[model samples]
Target: MNQELISHDGPGHRWLAERQVAGVKLGLERVKNLLKRMGDPQDTPAVAIVAGTNGKGSTSAMLAALCDEAGLQVGHFTSPHLVETRERYRVNGRCISAEQLDAALVHVRDCAGSDLAVTPFEVMAAAAYWLFRDLDLAVMEVGLGGRLDATNVTDPIVAVITQIARDHTRVLGDTLAAIAQEKVAVARQGRPVVMAHPTVTLAALRRIGLTCPVRKVGKDVQVQDVRIGGAGLGTQAVLRGRALSEPLQIELSLPGRHQLNNAAAAVLAYQEICAAWPKAWPDAVEVVWRLAEVPWPARLEVIETSPMMIVDGAHNTAGMRALAETMAERGKRWQVVLSVRDNRDPEPLIRELSAVSEGFWLPRMQADRMWDPHKLAEVIDLCAPHADVAVGSAQGCFEEARRQAHRSCGVVVTGSLYGIGEWLGRGEIVSPRLRRWLDGQAPQDQ
Candidate 1:
């Protein structure tokens, strides 16, 4: 079949899209059940499982990059591609080859025949496991809450939790502590855990410390030296006693200081992994280059020249805070293509964003779950008062913002990753991985 014929209309997309996954399977029984039927490929993989409220993609990207640099034939699994489904699965710093994906899916379908009436993620997890088992590495990002997430089926050498914050209240829980517990439960016994400054659940933190032998990022793996120039940036991780620093002065093409922190976390993860497997770890310079080379979209990504249009997936409070901080640091003013979750508290976020960006046209986001563009506008008015709030879908608001937005000023499409993908997809200028993933093309031998 021509590549053009494969689409949302095709059997492939429909099969996964139509069937929903259980957000909380509660146990690995179903995954184990599926694997037992297929052949347990994930039981003892050299894995780096990263769980967090924000920066999971960035952290995963960096982890995979560093691991690959360390001379490992890496396999990575992420979620909700900005462009294509294939972006969700990667091996050796590239999207999984079409041949690889096809073989894995064929086997998974055969074993899952009728018994694995599980969610789409469960099916993908199975497929990823099959593909990863053939590779030298297995770095997986948890799809949602950690405890019952499909990726949890893998036993990791390094279990990493990026940071803690609440986004999905309905499925996870109401309180921060409850949500943290759900995520921390993903940490298995004996693996060395690493994470950024966590402020969610003290109980969860204590539990992880006792049960999983954890390491707080800055405490265990700190950044000793950082140089941020243009085109690339590099930092040194104080790995145990050894100073793992690669001094490279450059700015990341991905944009934003938040990425720097994400980079820092990845460095820690890389250091920990290197210490765990010295024979596999490469030199520090190569790892730094690979980290800079990673492709993470919708984080202050500039796509236009005239009125530089940027998009980000700042969907939660922590994400919003990072976005605000990045904007403040840039000092380059911008108008926003804004939409926020209906469930999220708008006042605090509005107050933070007010210091940097403004809404372009509408009052808020669409009438989707936890989305209220109108409510967002009202909050902007009440909290920031000065920042203008946009009130339309990605396309509508973007067009309006383009017309009114000054050439000197820039456009930022943010507040939700959904909105970012929507606008960027429509515009056809999102990051290459997302675009290729959506298109389902195999990245040529690279």
Candidate 2:
């Protein structure tokens, strides 16, 4: 097995990997049952469930960061982590320790009993809930469609939908409307639902039987003067919403103009939760826009500066479009190291990458269900017929792309977050402790 794709070498991490064969079972029964056995820990925290095709992670991370800045005990649970599986859960901006994760898994296993079958995601969600039982708030990102996702078990104080697009069609649904319906299901009646996706409308949400008060971007909350400050400078915008008495200016550390909405949505959700439970969040708790310091891995993350190598997790067409736009605004075509999951449609991705790509290197990703590099090259041929493209191993592709990009252009390592993890495992930018853990050293020994 490719060591990069295998989360970590710890026994608990390995056990979680073993459950991956079951794939994604989209239902609430298993996860709900698992949490129930654990004494329903999800009920304690003021939960904010974020669901969308793209920008969900950025939104969730920003919300947690905002909460943390406000001196609130916050837990953040996101998915498809860039560095480690433990990155999926965080308390006060730090990832849950390897030992704590293992211990929590053990406790969950005991609670689950022998007969109850649970997926790794379900187990992780249950474990996160138990770990976060004492937290003032928990920002949970939905793994799949909102309706049946494991995180949906929590009744959130506020729900956020960030830029819903047509990805995950097989399970969520093929049409945009269908996907929107699936995502909006996370919101409960009488609670507030923050909608950041421009494509989804209030009428459509109501048609889908939504009774929740919808706080939408450009409507309930308004963002103006969105400025992309190159790669490192992040995006800047002036946001106005019901929660704020005056217009608030924000400069998100996460790049792209698309992040403006995500940031606005995060701020609004933070405000909504604070309003719902004012005692939990005192009146003195200020809305701190310390977003420029928030570090979300693999989302336009710059790992190398010599040739300006940027690693982004632009897995879908919508995300690719956003990435391509950012690269265009920077005025430099990139030497692209790209790979895609097997389930993704390679055409749109290839087309978007091609526009911003000086050349393309299709690498063999270390994750499961990846598109064969050579076969993917064939799709690239059709998408950008005049473009320069090649296929090779992950290391070789990155090295060659780096070499070519040294002339004047930069290198963009994208297509999937797992691809970023593969690079991290190879010592591109992984932390020393994580490096040892990836090298099969137990946390105690490290």
Candidate 3:
């Protein structure tokens, strides 16, 4: 490793940050070249590539937990970190340390050869491969559409797609079928492709002519006895599939009906790879129960009680609608603190929030991609002419929302993960577990 790049606060992070200027090039040549220079670290023995519009991160986390429970060393790579950049890489349920991240980035930077133009995400993907080169299995979440995503360079044993919806339409396409085709492009020939999306997307995949075998959730695997836990608890369901002789009961720490599909998809992917392991692994039931302990942050996560406040990273229209439906199912009115990335179309998200929230608070995130608060307020007013809207810093908006909310009402902080990270960084929300996890410390019991 380069001595200058090893300092956490020094040139290491700056080197990575400077590459942000290239910003989201949807191609594989740069990443492929970087990996080749790094001795093709992604050529691992076992790998699973997960792609979808919404639930891919949760599915990756669930799959990592199941593999860990079965006594396997697991490495997970996901995107858009909540608090720290190291959160994007994890091994055996723990975030990568700053030292480890800096070391890995040094290798990635050196391997890029000083001439190849690489994006920030591609660099991170390369570093993850270098950091976890010796792990037993790797679970990688596609940062964007799957076809040319930086994480797609690896030859995956199984490609999993969870709940395809309308997102990144400019690059992928405007139609659902077009998006589905891009998502399933990660599927390899003669390998199993696991999916948990609707029939429309399934039909779209078929229309695109999928050559690999597909194991669908509702068709190939059965999800029965679905139940949501009470009072902010997670969800429970039964999973039945060809991989198991009998139905497996599952309990998950992640909430929402959508998460059930993610869990089922993870289980199906696990089944596809279980036969390749050398030792006797845990039973399906045991793996399902162990999934309940996976701590995936900022997805309908509750941080406080009394004037209850929850933070979720729901940016797209479909994700916002799902959050609204989940709130409605609880029979509680909520106050919303919203911020969005500059690239997103905010009209639909604002309309969804207006339907579920009694009022809106518009906060400016510290990140460069955040939308302006003044323009966001105008959109909120246009969508919800009768609703009260406030604009300020995230901390000020959160404070005002808490003061205005009734004791029985819930408060939701959402729109972008960057906003949620800002909220957590300000120490306004007291979640020791999340704090510990971000700081590279083991989480304590709640």
Candidate 4:
């Protein structure tokens, strides 16, 4: 879709090189078609498919980390990177190197023709499977609605359903139960399809239990316990009459209360693996500790500088509420850099975010569906009238914001993962000296 990306040998360049003519409806035809052409690479590995309204990235990161701790070569493939596209493909706790991704891209692109109507996610699913064919474990995060999501191509050893909510109802369905059912379609055979859904959502999942094993978190493998703060939690995996006690406490560098479920889902999924492959399990304490130390961008990442540089992918009201809670407790005085795509509830979020920010700037973030800067600025003006505001292309506005940033002020770039990914990956603004010499010396915010 980009000039540099056309036939370019770069990490995840295959995603860019492949045709984006993918139909957006909820169906598995395109992925099935793509995989058929690729010789069914998705069936080659020990697969764990993760889907949810949110936390998929965090859960996938934890899963990969756990597999890595267990002395296995693991591959983690998540969508919407905070920095590089390569962040989507990690092998053994490491991002897939640019060279390796580039080579794989060349192979996938050479085989795919312009006539194919496959989506970019379909090609990526194929690439990750093709790349991880030799690995011991693989964690794949669904890109969209789960029923026909590209990652569903594989037969999951454990299908992880993180807490489901009302987001993406237009494509998946309107009701929470409907969305849960759509997302749950990735569950395979006798493998435990786990979820952290609330009671009502769990009820909907239970309806599908006759077809697959539904392992609800609180009911099946409870969080049992969690410590308040970034130190993560202490969890117990209770399945049937058996319980696995904690060998170590989980410590999360990421903030937000929601991360607790992500940590729980990862531990339980790991326990599921232990049940299947008892010999592959790691020390319980080590497993807990490993789960505690996962690094994902944008959830609660703070860039240390006077006035901090904070970035998050809070595209919905649920996410905005989480951001509000964290910032109220963590820091003060911030400028907000934000934008959103179509189908997102932008107006309500603008109202929520404006209450906390000192000023706001809206810009284009290289997303085809991203809201126009003029329209975004107009919405912010109505919602956050007390704060200073700027509108232009994201690059120009960010340049202006950086020029204004001092030791006493900070900036947060958010509203979508696409914006954060492009900004961080473009390699134009890595404040190395800021991290080295200016860490916490100035006001910071995210």
RMSD of 3: 3.2
The CA root-mean-square deviation of candidate 2, after full C-alpha superposition on the true structure, stands at 4.0
Give the per-residue lDDT of model 2 (tens digit) for 1-446: 13232445666666666666656698999888888888999999889999999999989988888888777899989887656677777787777777778778778878877777888778888888999999999899998988888999877899998887888898888988888888888888788988887457455578677687777787767888888755363688888766577787787767888888888888888878778876766331255456776777678776677877777889898999988988887665678888787878888898887776778888776677888888988998888876688988776887888889877468887887666676776765443433443344422233
Task: Report the alpha-carbon TM-score of model 1 versus the true structure.
Answer: 0.83
lDDT of each: 0.65, 0.78, 0.80, 0.67
lDDT of each residue in 1-446, candidate 4, tens digit only: 12223333554474555455454545678667766777777777789889988788888888778777778888889876554445567776556666777777656665665566666667667788889988878899998878778788776788888877778777878888888887777776577867777554556555666356666666545553444432121222222213346333556656566776677777778877777764757645566656445666566666544546666778877678767655554444567788787768688788777666777877666657778877877787788888788887657877777766563246767787666656655653453322221122211121
Give the per-residue lDDT digits (tens) of candidate 1, residues 41-159: 88646888888888877888887877777778888898766545566788776676555565666577677777567666787788788888867779899999888888887667887
lDDT of 1 at 404: 58
**lDDT for predicted candidate 2 compared with the true structure:** 0.78
Candidate 3 TM-score, true structure as reference: 0.93
Which sections of candidate 4 miss by over 4 Å?
1-18, 23-26, 82-84, 109-116, 209-213, 219-242, 278-280, 331-333, 364-368, 392-410, 426-446
Per the 3 Å backbone cut-off, how many clashing residue pairs does candidate 1 have?
25
Instruction: Output the worst ten-in-a-row residue range by lDDT, candidate 2.
Output: 437-446
Better of 1 and 2 by lDDT: 2
TM-score of each: 0.83, 0.91, 0.93, 0.82
lDDT at residue 25 of model 3 (Cα atoms) = 94
In model 4, how large is the Cα lDDT of residue 421? 55
- Give candidate 2 misplaced runs (Cα > 4 Å): 1-11, 198-201, 230-233, 241-243, 280-286, 428-446
- lDDT, residue 376, candidate 1: 64
